[model samples]
Target: MNILMALSQLEVTGAEVYATQVGNTLAQRGHKVFYVSDTLNSPHQGQYFKLRFNKRSLPRRVWHVFYLIYLIFRYKIQLVHAHSRASGWSAYVACRLTNTPMITTVHGRQPVHRSRKKFHALGYHAVAVCENIARQIVRDLGVAESQVSVLRNGVDSQVFKPLAANHGAKPVIQIIGRLTGPKGQLVYQLLEQCIDLAANQVQVISGSQIDPIFDKFKTKVKFCGYSANIRQTISQADLVIGAGRVAMEALMCQKPVFAVGEANAIGLISVDNLASAMASNFGDVADGGKTELDIDYPQLAKQLRSALKQPKVDEEVYQIITEQYSLEKMTQRLLELYQSAYVYTKKREIPIIMYHRVIHNDPSQHGVYGTYVTLERLEQHFQTIQRMGLSPITFQQLDEIGLDHRFDHGKRYIILTFDDGFKDNYDLLLPLLKKYQFKAMIYAVTGTDHNRWDVEHPSKPDQRFELMSPQQLRDIDRSGYVEIGGHTVNHPKLASLSHAEQQHEIAYNKAQLESLLERPLYSFAYPYGDHNEQTKRLAKQAGYTYTVATDSGPVALHEDLQQIRRIVMFPSTTKFGLWRKIKGNYTIKKAAKPQTKNLS
Candidate 1:
């Protein structure tokens, strides 16, 4: 999959660093990653485009939107992950214009206002870096809770693992951040009041130029400007002071962190206060009334004095980071979110459930193929669908509504398709459809009025069942609740036949079904779900707007109209199993198991 990481930053901030790390990890896993931002300081594996996404000028914002559109088409980007509000706005516009899917990661608290609430550009789904930001997004930005997820910043444990303890006479203290923001002021305050300059060796790792006011403490503090190897620099420190990703990386290295941020101060992280610290993203965000400017320097001095006295590594800190913030785990979750967002934006992956027969009594005598569900179970399934608020739609309805407007009616839809046009469908299923006010698509075999093909098969020679006659098919076709589709002349596997034979079976069946129903068939179902590329081509040539196969096809329905996938409703399938199969990622989970025969 091709992914674009979009950001708007003047310098390397935590958001930028996080995107870089995620992009590199995704690239290593064989996904093509592209980046667009104002500045990219970290090493990346994908192509980078330097765009001034930080600029909010009218013309610049317009240009960013158009440029992003071009990049998306140029790279065939499957998804876009915007990391900042400015970039998200432009990226969201571009994605809409191109019909592409995008997700935004809210790395920090956003400025909330009436306009922001009215037009929140957080993309199709929003990923918050911490729980505090997730709440803020849902509450202030007017984003739905269902669309927000809290995924904390992940650290590369392999590189940030604990190193040899610094065993010097003086404990080393490191302050990491850009030197022009609240962090820079915090550094100056710590040097002047919180830290005993004579007792500890201090180093400042910053990308910005050192402030001239720090020249007085020049002899006491060592200025190490912008080390690319942060892990190596962190290795020499007994105590690390910073917030957000900085605090996370430090904790991953088993070093105690004095967590202070642009929002508030969370004094020296310990297992006792770990939950509170994490809730505020280690003080990078404001979780309560206190702000960074409201810091009590005298009280902070006492905490610092105590921290320097006994700076020890905490095993629980490392364990938490390892379990909750591992790079691999974050990448996996992001991938799942990307697929879901893509399906949602495209709105083409409607669940098409396949059912063979609905029997009135026990199927123990003729359930060899596991294809029959009891009438009671069928009613239960319908009740579940109604309770879930899923609209049972036919292919005719879908065509009329159009793919883009599938979800516009404020209810999700699923296609209930019954194969083989069984007599039970006309007698047993039509009333349920009327009772539930639901619609279904039934595939009819034009050549026979009974299951002659299955009866003739050596494997199931005695499993004969009655198929709906032409009159029954016409009645259902005009019932306003069922759409009739062709299912070949004799229900033979098309893949095992010659090209001419396949065309005869597919085309002749369509002609026969049209003659009976007096309406053109819009869909075709491959018998036994057995179809190759040739069979799909034949079905298209026969003039089917859509075709379905069992258990094999792309997850996104629009990707291949001729071979759309369907979930088979087996006899033993429970309500939970039905729910799982109806989900968008069911194909992904199904593919992991061994291939099974298509009982249909």
Candidate 2:
């Protein structure tokens, strides 16, 4: 499938970066994904094309009209997927002339100026990143039920890991994103709300902007510039306060996040909820008719005051991030979405989830896999998605899902992939997937040394495990239910290996897996789910087309193809867990608040 993705701007933003990630992943999956950005010199792009679109010109449409046609011929694009409104309008024109399937993934609300309703009808399909936005596109924008679909923004759960959340005896809260533009004032808003709550218990931390306004709250506000250590910074927070998607990022760190309404990028906050959050009296009390309001500073203070009298840990949020929003589960959904899009004919991003070991009795083994989720919990996870009308698929069928097909069908779909075929995965988890009849990809690690460690024969002395045997792998592959990819012979960090060593690990494992499954194999999984410049070059040199990484963020078009990220779903989730995760309602509760710190 040939796909040409269009980007209106190249600023370091969520939308641009996300588009690149989607495009690259599509290319890796054997779909010819081409990216055309407003700026020709986009740092994150592949096979770039120049699309002449100047908003200033009266007949800016004139340049767009011709360029759209030109791009059709240039890329032989069967479909055009535009990221932003301006680009969507241009792509709509091209779709009209070329009669090609053009879709504008309506990431957010339609711009106030453009005749978005009309432009939306011009395209074959539309995608909204969140349910609130999707409902708005359908209700307010008047896009047809058939034309509009919900494809929420996803994150690679692993890349964004939970760090030590302790504050060295002082409470800390992390605020993310740039302080310029709409995000700048959020610090002040947060500070306003936290003033009484943070008086002495919390040290507010912002990773970027340092503004004079924050000086007023100097004792409580912390301004740290562009923290490279996201996990560490987020870990210290007793609470995570952020704007827009940063709220979700804070959630990924397993911290409870309270977002000021102005910071919510997707506009999911209902005006009423903001009013409730703003209501000063209730301190984290559950009003019977109204949902429990959790952000009231007085209520929070009461809770903190109560907590101070008891025993509590600082790393509490870490547990939630791993359980509900990990890269493993996220990637599982991503793979499902990709495969669904392959067959459905719409443009969207999907992540392939990666999980390490599943646990039995040994606490050490359980630690390696993080908290082990019970099988009953797994059943609830699958049941939640099933009830929601999302069809879970396996990784092998991903190749069969046609990208040109997702639109015409009313049903939305996704693929579930589990990386690093661990013993517990085969024993406990595979049964559930089989019960559900879902498909997934398993990147097997093969080699002389790898085969020696048997998972079934765990030694009492911290029993190290073994990779699945070639015969067992063949049995799994023969079922036609799973796709076997290489996970290198040894599970060392790919970035640490020499180029030649990396090639051998990748190439040799590919051949070994191919012989076991007797199938064409080309996909590669980074060992430790880690990849660097050297590792990526080695994968290409070794002939694998698709590679997955641990970077925690949603897949987008402009992202580098080989360096993709996924979510790691863990055991901490409850019955309502998968629902909130899938329906994109993680931070909808505390959608609005105020912040005092700024991070530039």
Please name the candidate that would achieve the greatest TM-score relative to the true structure. 1
Model 1, which residues run further than 4 Å from truth? Answer: 288-292, 349-600
Q: Which whole-number lDDT from 0 to 100 does residue 38 have in model 1?
A: 93
In candidate 1, the residue pairs with backbone N, CA or C atoms under 3 Å apart (3 or more residues apart, or in different chains) clash, namely none
The Cα local distance difference test for each model comes to: 0.84, 0.55
lDDT of 2 by residue, 83-159 (tens): 77777777777777776766666554454335655556436556655455555666666766655555544445655
- Residue 403 Cα positional deviation in candidate 1, in Å, after optimal superposition: 23
Please give the lDDT score at residue 564 for candidate 1.
85
Q: What's the TM for model 2?
A: 0.45
lDDT measured at residue 402 in model 2 versus the true structure, 0 to 100 = 45
